[model samples]
Target chain A: MKPVYRFDGFIFASLIAGLILTIMPLPDAINAWRPAWPAMLVLYWTLHKPERFGLLGAWLVGIAMDTLTGTLLGQHALALMVIAFINLKLHLRIRVFPKGQQALAILMLVLVYEFLLFWVDGVAGFATSGIARWLPVLSSAALWLPVAALLKGAMVLARRA
Target chain B: MAGLKPTDVLPGRGPALGTRLFLLLACSILLMVLDSREDYLQYIHSKLNIVVYPIQAAVDLPFALADWASTSLASRRQLLAENRDLRRQQLRSDASVQKMIAIEAENARLRALMDTAALMTDRTMVTEIMAIDLNPYRRLLTINKGSSAGAYRGQALVDAFGIVGQISDLGPLSSQVLLISDPEHAVPVEINRNGLRTIAVGTGDAQILNLPFLPNNADIRLGDLLVTSGLGGVFPAGYPVAEVNQIEVNPSQPFAHVEAAPAAELDKVRELLLIWPGDVQDQ
Candidate 1:
């Protein structure tokens, strides 16, 4: 007899880990450079398994992130749902591209995510903290290759079991 | 790939992406508007926070363990030295407190004779900061004390040096504080030098506070101490707020460019005193 690895369980674990990483504290100098973990996870899952993780899942995760980060409710929800939507539309074309090209797409997606956030903050009259807010986009882009590879490896192992 | 079914290899499609996107976007927009316009969602947010608290605790576990290790494994000599230093600092603080007590008594008597209101006997609860806001645009902190500890919105948070911030959101087991250094926050303060009243606004920089709308000829100068004016009733009177570090006055300009260093260690302080004002008296 062999054990079966559930896709739902695998996705759940990765999302939870993503949530933790999204809120983990970092030093002041590099905190802004921390990758957008939940966004990246949403991109990967939406790209790989669009049926399992969609805009709704991204919205829920974003709301939880809002609560965790203590920001205005729905701010991240709006941004992440948009990200998920874009990823869903482009997932087919994106999945076939090489890792480097995929990372470029991820960069554009993350930039769109951050831009939505910045617009909301502006309308709310919140002061922008220099240009450090955009650092996460670059970091998230740099992180996509490894994150996608890890998720791919995990899915393969889970399916084999 | 040989063993897997065609369905297993292909991505399963979900609901119409466009429709789902539109619906979620509308719902999210509604939520963001409600959250910003009213305090109606506070309880819901607080309840949702409970679901996420465990994750936050898990993230903080490593730091907590290291802190515990350091405290538990310190050498006897180091402990003794720390104790000696604390004792000496306490003695010096005691001397200043003794003088404060006499001055407060005199102030009370004078107020009574003049038929003015007396100061409330403020009670304070010590709380440790649990988390800090990473978004540099917003200055906020979550503290361990909450509604369970009698924490309420608008309660003043202070440190040994001076006032730090105010409790903005209260939860069951935790509360969020808006630091005084937040760009959106402003505190009414009086110059200790000439009793000049002004509003000190945060400049988005940790060390600088902007004193806006001051007359170019206002008797403010560099190195003046600013204390809470208690005008808005948000903060009590007489706590140190900031020290004037730079003052630029131009004859052509209607206002002076005044910047001050916040008296409280806003960036570094870990412990805060949650002040609960005891009573309200009519002046």
Candidate 2:
């Protein structure tokens, strides 16, 4: 199947939609349930087509997140780029994995991203970054099924076309 | 003839390696510099919000519908009960206000006799809480009132109970009110029962506020009620701010680490009043 149709306009638009979700005003109680939509969407696309979308796209999307969420600048950008780079490196082997294992890989990638964030902020002495910040990784994993299905649907549509 | 063989070049290398990394590093450094020291990002913070606002509104759709459903489903009996309760409470408040007016008159007379400072009545505006600010660590809420509606920066937001925080960020349609419980926010307060003054700062944890610099032997009791001292010219005096919850003293340290709970129901605040004194001669 041609990679051109799946990873171009639709991918960029999807990333923006994910950013919209990231900025959506959820109350404190429910915010923990909000998945890391942008990270998941970007990583999925990067794994699908590393040739068209790569580290730069992920980094830029992350920087947009940083600006939108008003967090430590470049933190998400750096994390996203690393996620993309590693996923791209594993795309060949990862593509053959069972659905469950693939989901596990995504979880590991998200955990790595969270670890980087923890290391960076912990050293900076801004206390109370809190246990809550890392909760999104678990939430993102729980959200993986719908995301994988959506991406698979898009890929199937492109193949039929 | 001038071209080098392909093997000489690194496989992963893209053009202008140093320049790209330099630009990336430089841009982020510039961003950090602007965000922290220069405050240049505030303009971007203000304007880009317009682009993001539509998406935010769309995101709030489910919440709005939920609120609508709950209100619409309220039984007529419940509505009547609520109305009756409100009316009874209003009457009780009116009677108390009448008594307060008489007492205030007596107070003015006594103050005139003694040549003492008189109490000032603050002008206030009612503003609806639109939504909480997206930053989880920062305790800020957006109020429906804005510059067009006569809201401005540095104005304190309060409820019937006591002070919440001041309007720190202003937009055209709404203003961002940072809560007094934010780590960066500090309110000058006095213990009304004993007249002990201290500054209560937000501790970044939503549940606790810190009162720094109270002497280890400061005449503070465990349950002392704290009120705004009116030292900053922002908040009015005699409004409840917090109740002293815990105090820890180290024998080596001169000051005690005093913690108190916030006066307002911050997590549950749906509506608040913007307290602006009408006799703001400075403005």
Candidate 3:
């Protein structure tokens, strides 16, 4: 019999950290390179435990993000919900892939997430900073490997504890 | 396995995936439409802002600590030199303010003679800029003041040098400022040299503002100073806004392509003065 899956404190802690990182101010030189921390964290939770942290969880996190960032209401929520849905459908196949292929898939997912945000901004008449708006997508993809490893280690530690 | 029903082959969750997605999508679209079209969501956003205050403060704590450390660790000699420099600067400004007081009195007397309404002095308060990163696409600042501090929406913000921005979103403990450098922002400005009025709009660059309505034959020169015209009713009159840096008068184009550098260091401002206009009584 499989063990029961529950929403754990570990996931809650990581999500809070992600929220903090998303709004943390950096030096202007590299501000554009700040990764989509919340999006990546949502992706991690959904991919690892879809039954526990599914579309509703992603939507809530996105709502918090929109409120924090002062974007048009529901903008981030919509983008993140779509990302969660895609991961829910493909987690099984993508999880089985090699590390490099998994990273590529994660990159595609982040790109889609950013594209949705861009589309929303365009439709809402919010002018986006040209080229600079796409920088986070690349940074998010590049940091995915290290973030995944760190989260995996933390999960193992939590399980042991 | 033979006895099990075919419908039970895959255990269904609370709701099907597609159904949930569609419901959530519909809800989000409704929210966006409501948010963009009206002010119905402002109250909810302001209330939700209280929940995120702690997160914003946590992110700001490190920077605050570093600033405190630097100030507390400064040597007495450096402090004394800084005090002396400030004293000299204060004396110079005091002399200028004395002259300004005289000029203001004479101007008010002249206005009274002309039977014009008295020019009311704006009430001002200092607010520190919170160290929080807002949307990168828009030039927004989160200041450490909110409705509790009597900061209302659409209040004008200015730095020592010039106008900075206006309050966009207000929470209970903090407010967000939409800088003049945002692409969506526009200010009515008149050239100080000629009083030729035009609207200066932000071009998504912190240093540049575009004046798109100026005719090619408009008597605007490079280095002309732009000041608020008071027509928009948001910003007060005669505050320096920008300085015209470039102008291209192309015969083919009806409107000249002109750009100006903002007078305020919009990207570097750490403290801002919130001004209540003459019409709005300061709380």
Candidate 4:
């Protein structure tokens, strides 16, 4: 958990919304275009306000994702928590970066999450990585732009209020 | 991306970096073992699914809404046409029922064929599909019937047309069905007309199945209907499974690649039945 001290109902609502969008019916070709929206948003909150949504929150939400999508149990839970933990550790440095560089960092974090997924899946005797499976990471990279912008805007609005 | 920074700060950097990292790594490793070596995690899957059901139900809400909205203005002409169509379908089904009754009567008369030894029939649970897996490579569908409906792993699920697939996972109130067209699934079938047995494997398309290893110039043809042979005993005998669409014989390959279409319409299925054999002896 970070050093933030607020309930932030709006942020939690946005995270739920992101999870809803994650489960929506995306076309097969663009299905991989479905990014790690929930994870990215979770990371943004964990970094910007680490105290509220911490590693435990990430782990629970990840389990919910795996269950909702019927993936192998603990798959997304493990990946999400790892990424969230990393972000928490680098909370100060991540906030200092400019928008463009921050996006790059988010991309790298998502990349690590994807790699962990591939490795964990392989370890369990599941089939090796397929080329199409990586399409989400590319989509996740592109998705960072809007997600970051939304969080940035939300924080601004909160401050003004 | 310019905005005010987060101000509601709480001191969360309690655990050192190394400690959290070690805990995370340890937790993941434990999870991996539980997921792999231990099959009992099915209970965990079921409980978690119950927790996330609202999310799934929410995701499915739009489709349900769309379906509801689509039929609002269904015209009288369409209803009449559908009634006529359903009437004709009912008539066609009645004929099959008559044929089944006749077969039952004949079998009763020929009691010597198989003993009338108290074969208890297993009950069937009707299930509706909640959602289909759009993953082209992995053919899976979430069904409404689950452990609550007495659906178990490896139970056979069939439709009005023929065998669709079997239950792969038994969730709390929902289970995952692996369609016959999935790459990982295979069904034992026989040519209904000739009784030549062969294993039909999923070709990753609901419309196509691959029948491998019939000798060159074997007597299989286009439009030949294949039915379950009951050899593997997983499925009941004499259910339409597929129709041979194309058969290729390559002299150099030493094996004929025969392709067929599954009789069960995976794309259009709304309701399914989880059935077990009546005769436990045969099963």
Best by TM-score: 3
lDDT of 2: 0.74
Docking class of 4: acceptable
State in Å the error of residue B141, model 1: 1.7
Put down candidate 1 lDDT per residue, B1-283, tens digits, no spaces.
2465445433444445687788888998888888888687988877887877777777767878888999999999999999999999999999998999899999999999999889866778799877888787888888888888888888898898888989887787878899888888999999998899999998767898899979999998888999998889888888999999999989898899999999999999878999876544233
Compose the digit string of candidate 2's lDDT tens values, residues B1-283: 1353443232245634344445554665566555654455656655654555555456556777888997899999998999999999999999999999899899989998999877767777787766565545667766667677777778988877778889876655666778998776899999988888889999876668898889888988778888999898888777888888998988799899889887877777778988776444342
DockQ, per model, reads 0.55, 0.29, 0.57, 0.37
What is the number of residue pairs that collide in model 1?
0
lDDT of 2 at B41: 65
Error of 4 at B68 (Å): 3.3
How many Å off is the CA of B259 in candidate 1?
0.3
What TM-score would every model get versus the actual structure?
A: 0.92, 0.78, 0.93, 0.84
Candidate 4, B111-153: lDDT as tens digits: 7566754334455768877776634466788888788776778
**lDDT for B124 (candidate 4):** 71
* Pairs of colliding residues, candidate 2: none
Q: Give interface RMSD (Å), model 2.
A: 4.9
Query: In candidate 4, how many Å is residue B33 off?
Result: 2.7
Q: What is the lDDT of candidate 1?
A: 0.85
Error of 1 at B80 (Å): 1.0
Ranking by lDDT: 3, 1, 4, 2
Ordered list by DockQ, greatest first = 3, 1, 4, 2
lDDT of 3 by residue, B1-283 (tens): 3454444333255579999999999988998999898678889878988988887788778878998998999999999999999999999999999999899999999999999987778889899887555567688878889999998988899999888989888999988888898888999999999899999998768999999999999999999999999997999998999999999999999899999999999888788999987754456
Candidate 3 TM-score, true structure as reference = 0.93
Name the lDDT value of residue B259 in candidate 1.
94
